[model samples]
Target: MSDKGLFISFEGIDGSGKSTQARLLADHLRDAGRDVILTREPGGSPGAEEIRALVLQGDPDRWSAETEILLFTAARRDHLERTIRPALAAGKVVICDRFADSTRMYQGLSRGDLRGVVDRLHDLMIGVEPDLTILIDMDPTEGLSRALSRKGAEERFEDFGEDLQKAMRAGFLALADEFADRFRVVDGARAVDDVASDVRAVADGFLPKRRV
Candidate 1:
């Protein structure tokens, strides 16, 4: 792949500060004069946004594991076709807040089948993988507490309870271990600025030489 552009993704449990760091990195890159596009999965494009509403705020009891996975992929397909691919083709650095990994974690928690879902999605859609994935690792209990304290509402899968979140965390960690080269697990317990700095360092490693 060319250094002209890069696709970097931030992944983590809710309240792990992935969005915060993603925005910070985008700002840093923009200040340094890099063309960057900061976006999120499940809602990047118009079609995806509608799907996101359904998936996130709609009736959870009406959703099955298979149906949920399909909805996610449908949104992802729209996002890629409408936003991600175009930005990358324009040679802009693309920073996605959440991507396929989130689906693997969430759906894996709901379904207990990680390998099949991830592999099938990779095969069917999601042609380009992130150049680097920053997995903001945090303890599920702490992360959940922070999330609930901050947001004050549990939507859809987040309402699945604490044990599910813990299992999802374990799934993410296991993926990090298996794909060491592609994954960077950052300790998310640090101060916000500290975590952002760590994320910036990881991003800079993939970026071309430039003073930030």
Candidate 2:
């Protein structure tokens, strides 16, 4: 990790507006003259993109819980090596829409254990933890409804019933409690600008003496 760069990740269940908030934070930082790189997990690199498509679009029956976790970690490893790490090394703040936290929530909801997966990936990736992680917390049912209302299609995970989404949201909250110092939970049900302002506040607190 470069001393001059800050790594921030935005995480939440579907339709919690993580992508929007991530872009807003990156724009705020860039306008303040900080070099910024906005990216997403399960992607951000060629190899990772392929893995993303496979995981998101492939046959649901073909992927077990353990296999899903491994695939996510594999994509994350590539993303870190090819994109996130290099950007941070160059002193650019990196804003990722989702990172290792998603794996913990999604896989933990499905498989019931994420400690081994998280530990193994952290070791292999050489401690690429985010300086700040903003989780846009919301009711899973509401979030999923929003997601389905906005996007007409569903991926393998999104295809899961509402109960699964609720489980995932609970998993996220549990993980946030486990990493309270590094995680911030935002009210995702608020208006876009309100949520954006909250995100800006959290990010500005970690940035190098800047304003949003």
Candidate 3:
């Protein structure tokens, strides 16, 4: 590890249980006597949280793919400045629920072929990737079912329907292959504790040995 603490991100199609896994990992790390901060993307900082409302709780057609990319990038910049960077610099493990990889899929590929745009914006503004990215892979159909059952206002993306979810799952898997060094794929179709165990093991391999 660098003088800075480790950074880990959990990603998956909607309702794949990545969020639950992220929290569990944070708890586990803290129990093991490591400093940890659990945060989420598009809403980590005050400013970003406002933007998150704009982007996540509107019509599916609320913004063009390009506009959404810009919004996500702006929110991410704020999140990094206000939350992720400081935590990592202070030697606290940063566990993020979602990060730029979501942008690389949702806005980058879902609507059009704008991945290059996403990558360029990310490099220019938020030029950081998680030290470890745990992708909780799941079947898109089931994932969508789980997502819609939540009946939350943040279902704008889920409103895009099963097609988008399928695309997202494939896109996430592809990202895992593309950034294989930092990405770890874990099955998320089992019981919560079982999935959490897999996530914990994957994270444990990346985390440095705890200081005694």
Candidate 4:
């Protein structure tokens, strides 16, 4: 936890139901009377949202791996300054849809062998890690199928297709191992509620007791 607040992030390959689960967890915590701020990366603040459209839309090759790294870092800086840090300072529970780990996988491993670049930039610009990161693990084939069905405009990463999704799945799992202390892997292959139930259970173990 940072600044007396609980910071939680959810991650998985695209269409792995992480977004839905993040929202559900936010709702659950709110019902339990915790102050919660649910937001997403690359778009939590206005400035970052603009950058999000640039990076998340258009062709998959819209930007080179090196260039995407800079753009994402900039967006994250603004997001941290304007959204995440302030929420934490207020002692609210911050549930993010995706965070730096997504960049570590997408731009770091997926596009090229530039993980060092991503890490260096992150350490320099935004140095905060979530208190807990919930990784919704799913089968790549199933995840890709679900992602394509969305037909959303922010499908640039999804447009990379199944092989990338498979790679992302493996990379994310490796990341969980690397950051094992804070990463919790939940099976996303199950029904949404079942997955959420597991996620809630995992989160409860980390959450502090409610204030009197």
| Candidate 3 lDDT by residue in tens digits, 136-209 | 99999999999999999998999999999999999999999999999999999999999888888888888878
Steric overlap count per candidate:
0, 0, 0, 0
RMSD of 3: 0.9
The candidate, 3 or 4, that scores higher on TM-score is 4
Q: Ranking by TM-score, best first?
A: 4, 3, 1, 2
Candidate number of the best TM-score: 4
Q: Model 1, which residues run further than 4 Å from truth?
A: 2-4, 152-154, 210-212
Task: Give the best candidate by lDDT.
Answer: 4
Which runs of model 3 end up more than 4 angstroms from their true locations?
1-3
Better of 2 and 3 by lDDT: 3
TM-score of 3: 0.98
Instruction: Provide the overall lDDT of each model, using Cα atoms, as 2-decimal numbers.
Output: 0.83, 0.83, 0.93, 0.95
- lDDT of candidate 2? 0.83
Give the TM-scores of the predictions, in the order they appear.
Answer: 0.92, 0.92, 0.98, 0.99
Per-residue alpha-carbon lDDT of model 4 for 120-166, expressed as tens digits? 99999999999999999999999999999999899999889999999
Q: Candidate 2 regions off by >4 Å?
A: 1-3, 152-154, 210-212
Superposed by TM-score, candidate 1 places the C-alpha of residue 53 at a distance from the truth, in angstroms, of 0.1
In what order do the candidates fall by lDDT, top score first? 4, 3, 2, 1
